[model samples]
Target: MTDQLTYLLQKLDASAHRYAELDKYYEGRQPLAFLSPEARTALGSRFGRMASNIPRLAVTALAERLRITGFSDPALWADWVRCDLDQTSGTAHREALLLGDAYVIVWADRLGRPAVSVESAKQVTVMTDPGTRQITAAVKRWEDRIAKTSTAVLYEPDRITRLVANQIGAVGSGFKVVDEIANPLGTVPVVRLHNSDRILDRHWHSEFDGRGHSEIDDLIPLVDALNKSLADLMTTSEYVGRPRRWATGIELTEEPVLDEDGNETGETVEVNPLPESHRMMISESPDSKFGQLQAADLQGYEASVRVILGQIMAVSTLPAHYVGVFTDNPASADALRAAEASLTARAEARQATFGRSWEQVAKLMIAVRDGRDPQLIDDVRVQWADAATRSVAQEADAVVKLHQAGLLPVSTALAKLGYSADEIAEIRVARRAEALDTAGLDLGRPA
Candidate 1:
């Protein structure tokens, strides 16, 4: 038991650094950390850790779109509501997007219902079976940095074990079993929300044990480039973006004398120093003529910024508008839809993956409710809200066009426009009643 717990703890310790680093990037602190001391001086003391934060925008855009409205089963949906998952699940989704993984732990509460807890990747780690890719063991671990102690719970197929060790962040810190419970649930109750998980054949994240990847991996380099461009622009604006004035022929003399009695104190200075360029600086000398130094052309800097932003948009799968990029011309409907295509595809992909994990959570909740493993409700499905980006008017117009072309029935068109089954049923009943009323009125009128 000691050896097994030690192994999981060691794995968790190894992964914690990665989780913290990703979190820093998602919070917009990573780019500025790389700023050289000279760059910081150039940026000014007032500016500390300022960057574009487009990575956060990218992560947030996808996380907000992956909404779980409910489950297909009423009982499961009810359980979800009881757990307040509709609100709490957003945290889980965001953490997964930021950290490459998140965890949902389900256990029986005192009320005989499932209790749900959300955990960041730093707090949890799992051992997966190579052939089946199933979690054979999982751990939720916590540490007190000041106290230098670690407390953890390990979930295996047939038992739950709690272990604690002092001298955390040290080598060979042994963990002793503090408590144990036999598992009647028959399987691990921890569900992982792993972002960008890839099959071993196609996996590229060899650095972190070939585990799941994250949006940060694609965004960080782009963000750094973008920040560099922004910083350059700022520097140019501060020092050399605008024109400087020169007056070589000016006869301005250096003399200064000031006292209450008008005595010469002999502190020499330019007779009339250069005034702000916003106003005229007329020299008294007949030959005095002002020449302007050419300002640095900022167009190229702006173009570089846009180019880096384009790269960011491409890598993050975010539309231009999401990163606050837009053209002089208002975006056409087709253009808007085209821009959102990749983003919509990414959201749907997440739904398909995160939905599987949510389904397992529902099953685990059912296990808690029934006091046994949920082998019966294997077909549980998660109902996700539509992540497609389109205005209602546009969708309605498309539906009408499809109906007019005889390509889609009214019901199917309504479904395409995101009507629920119950809402469609109600509409059908109301339409039938209206038709009957019209027929009765026609019969009574003159036929």
Candidate 2:
């Protein structure tokens, strides 16, 4: 189970990366649809042809790779897509709950009142003295009343015993503890509700809406509604049609002047300082925008992925969505297939690398710990050198760029070869000294 779960996480990570890649490719969009002739013409035939399939291919491929249920079920997958769109629109509405309390129906005749006499009234109270505090509650009734009403008391020992005994029956050996006024230690009793039949006449309704409604019915619509709501909210949430990326309000409307005369000069212009009202406003905060988008995407993506993976793990057969997915759009179909392949490869590679690296790091640590482990140190050093060479070859440009930036940690150079922290630190300390005659420092310069 752990291995399977780990595989799934790695798969999820790869799927996320692919999604991000495709998002960049298409500049963030949904699946394409059949364009009207005029719309296609305006976009140009090639543009219309390729551009339309981008989202479908990306999302479909990601789903297929994730092995979600809808992959085999087109209709179900379509619903899921609709679900995604619905969630994206962000129409969130709260659900209302029904609350109720337990009540009893008493017989007016038993209480010495005529059933037809509506004017007469009767009242009864149940009280319990817990020794620390006394709780009292009253039930009021009118003669000839046929409906039910509620009377609540603190859930004291007597009330609970009564409710339980009334509901379950007094047959079993049951006991309860009650607080005593004199002795703080408390007292126990083999007890039961005195008037079980009388109490049983009342029905206990959950105080909150306890209607057993299908969550699927509620959740699907809710997610769709939330997406719609979000779409509407976004349109009004921020400054729309502003020229500057992060500019808002008057600052966006105001033009910069090159000179005091306000002439249209080619020289650099100094814009007026932002007004007080919009002073703190920014056109866009990359961090905030990125974070929000990521969070929203994460929620929907995670839910969809979980559902898909669950189906894949449970069923021996693939869903119809998986088959119909190919027919949806060719480009997307290809992408989806590729995404599936990519996810599997990534998961396998991550598992293999993690295990291998952990072992290498451990061995290096042991080698550095004591001076007599030269062979072990040499073996690990050889492995690190081979890995480094492959890494450089795979992405030399990225490596050079990273080296140029101070962003790469000082420890990275020492640790990149898979040395343990202590091992790396010991090397650094020894290297800085005048001369290292120590046994641990002679790894022959980290390759």
Candidate 3:
């Protein structure tokens, strides 16, 4: 059952992706609004009259053909919400999704004045029977056509409470996203795509066994299952593609800002003395040290791996030993611990403050000494990842790299690194030109 579930999920996911691709290509090339009346007539004449009652294709039907029943429409959303809600209790459960009553108000004037007076309000409720748990939605529309502006809600016991917590995290916490996985079925594809972030190593495992009993008895196997799922799906999809043009490497190689004696003068953030050719393009070359490397080259992967290693290395630092050593000791351990602590502090600060930690800082520091802000290094990684995901072909693996490294926020990270958003945009354009040049393709031809 599990194996079958996994296979079905993969098929569904792949099918959905194919459909999305078709939708995008069709939408771009053929816009309903852009069609002239003559063209419309011509098409109609050729293909017969358009059906007014062209039935909406059921997602289940689509998924069935694609072999992805688990991810089909109401089944996907309903199961996802249910699984997610099951993880919470009390307020969290309520806040995540609430079910209650909502009133739809309509204004009407019987006397024929400038505005309509209050006519009537209809009460709507989403309720589930305690005995049967058969959920039903009840709504009373004012007119035969039903009020278009009417608002309806489900009275899930705990959604509102969860929403409040999420709101607080968004406002008070510096982090941008707080994601959790709730997998009711182990072999589902949506769980993999919706959660399993590569950087954080977060994935979903069934909380209960196949028979619906708690599977938390041994946490190891569950965690291993989740990890295995992530590993399997790691390189299957790309959110964006790499640039199309050939990149001849960065210019401005003379170290532009050197003094008469050629000693380092400006701060790390100071403009690189190199000309346009040597200028760093975060979008093209996220690993600043190797600006023009191909996406196929292991440079990005190696760089990301190094960043993760750095964080892991930093974890070895101990504060207690470093804080009290004073005798005529070599203090090698203390020194190492302090350095690690500094790195750890910086990483934790970045993660806690913004949900993203600078995994590329150590790699960038190797390119130039004096410890530049990890934000700058991170920005370059993100921009490159974004470019790859957005531009590269769907089959390309660049999207997987970006998604795995959690480097999609390159522009924002660059902004934090002291580059204005506009400057970053210009840099992206230039980098895109280089990548496209390298790939022997044109960047401006539409997308």
Which residues of candidate 1, in runs, are more than 4 Å off?
32-41, 44-48, 145-148, 167-172, 201-209, 249-272, 275-289, 328-330, 394-447
Candidate 3 shows a clash count of: 46
lDDT of 3 by residue, 332-351 (tens): 64454344454344323322
Query: Per-residue CA lDDT of candidate 2, range 1-447, in tens?
Result: 223222322322323343343333334333224334554344453332232222222223222221111121122223323334223211110000000011211111343321111111111122223453222222221222233322211122223222112221111122112321221111111111111112122222422111111112222232333333333233223323222333324333445445678675664544644453553644443543211121122345335534443343223122224423333332544454443443345323323322332233323233323323323344332112111112334355554557679666656644444444446557878777736555446766586
| Tens-digit per-residue lDDT, 1-447, candidate 1 | 556666766777777667777777778777454567787887875455658888788888998888776566666666676777877899999888887788899988888888988887787878778788878788888878898897888899899988778867532356677899997888888888888647752234333244567777888877877777777777787778888877767665787767889888978777646756448776677887878899888899889988888888788788878777767223687777788889999999999988888988888888888876666666788877678878889889988998999999987776677765556667999999999999999999964
N/CA/C clash count, model 1: 0
Q: How do these models rank on lDDT, best leading?
A: 1, 2, 3
C-alpha RMSD between model 3 and the true structure:
33.2
- The per-residue C-alpha lDDT of model 3 at residue 283 equals 33
Q: Which has the better lDDT: candidate 2, or candidate 3? A: 2
Query: Residue 130 of model 3: what lDDT?
Result: 44
lDDT, model 1, position 147: 89
Please state the error at residue 70 of candidate 2 in Å: 51
Q: How many angstroms is residue 332 displaced in model 1 relative to the true structure, after the best TM-score fit?
A: 4.0
Instruction: Specify the highest-lDDT model's number.
Output: 1
* Model 3 accuracy (lDDT, Cα): 0.27
